[model samples]
Target: MVRGIRGAITVINNEEQEIIKATERLIKEIIILNQVAPENVAHIIITVTEDLNATFPAKALRSFEGWTYVPVMCSREIPVPKSLPKCIRVMLTVNTSSAQADIKHVYLEDAIHLRPDLQLTDRHL
Candidate 1:
């Protein structure tokens, strides 16, 4: 079955390095938590807050050898009032045996505030 795993993270600045680091961290957590292999990933969609245009989050994954064959795309998030800033979010679709409720969705840094109900542990990269 195809399952979707979601994750988000907040960056400290709009610099290319910061954006890349934060996006890498977020994707790593998502992959680890979901136990997803690159071969199993169908596609990944990433979005960043309008304030962050320094680089595309997908660009960071290029350095990961496993991601070379994975399909990935990036776009700007909808500008919602009072939304978290410097946030990068991703929805990764993968072929998995896990149930929807069993999937782990990661939210890190200030982006954790965006999904209080997930009650994820406080972890920083």
Candidate 2:
């Protein structure tokens, strides 16, 4: 079976380091929460808001020891009017046995506003 785990986090700046850090943190939390193994991840799609263009968000995954072979693509998010800024969103497509409803979607920092219905008690990770 195939399933997608969605995640998003906001960065304090458009700088490469901040974007990379936020992306890494977001994906790490999603992996921990979902108990996902890198080997099972089919691919990852990372999208950044229009205001953030320092670097590709996919660069964050390079530091992961087991994710060297994982396929990843980075792109710009559609610029909607009055949308969240400095945000990075990720869609991790994986081969999993879990049902769709069992998948946990992570939204951290200001990005939580993008999906309040999916937010947990914690503010950010």
Candidate 3:
């Protein structure tokens, strides 16, 4: 059985290093929390806010995960008025036997503010 997990974060800058670091951390947490195997991951789609076009977050993730052949895509978020800026969002489709509720959805750093009902302190990864 495969499932998808959603995670988001807000970057302080458009620097590649910052995006890479934040994405890696969030992705790692998602994988660890869900106990997902690398082979189970079908594909990943990452979107960065319009203000961040300096680099593709997927590229950094591919490098960090050492997944040279994985299907990854990057796109720009819709420039909606009054939307969260400097945000990097990820939608991961993975093959797993875990329930939806068991899948950990991460909202890191300032992005935590998006889901105030979630217990950020419950993050174990």
Candidate with the greatest lDDT versus the true structure: 2
Residue pairs with backbone atoms closer than 3 Å in model 3 (clashes)? 1-96, 2-96
lDDT of the structure predicted as candidate 3: 0.82
TM-scores for every predicted model:
0.94, 0.94, 0.89
The residue-by-residue lDDT of candidate 2 on 4-116, one tens digit each, is: 99999998888999999999999998988788899999999999989999999899999998999999999999999999988899999998888998888999989999999
Candidate 2 backbone collisions, by pair: none
Writing each residue's lDDT as its tens digit, candidate 1 over 14-67 gives: 999999998889888788777889999999999999999988889989888778
Better of 1 and 2 by TM-score: 2
Selected candidate, larger lDDT, 1 vs 3 = 1
How well does candidate 1 score on lDDT at residue 66? 72
Query: By descending TM-score, how would the candidates be arranged?
Result: 2, 1, 3
Best by TM-score: 2
Runs of candidate 1 exceeding 4 Å displacement: 122-125
Q: Compare candidates 1 and 2 on lDDT and give the better one.
A: 2
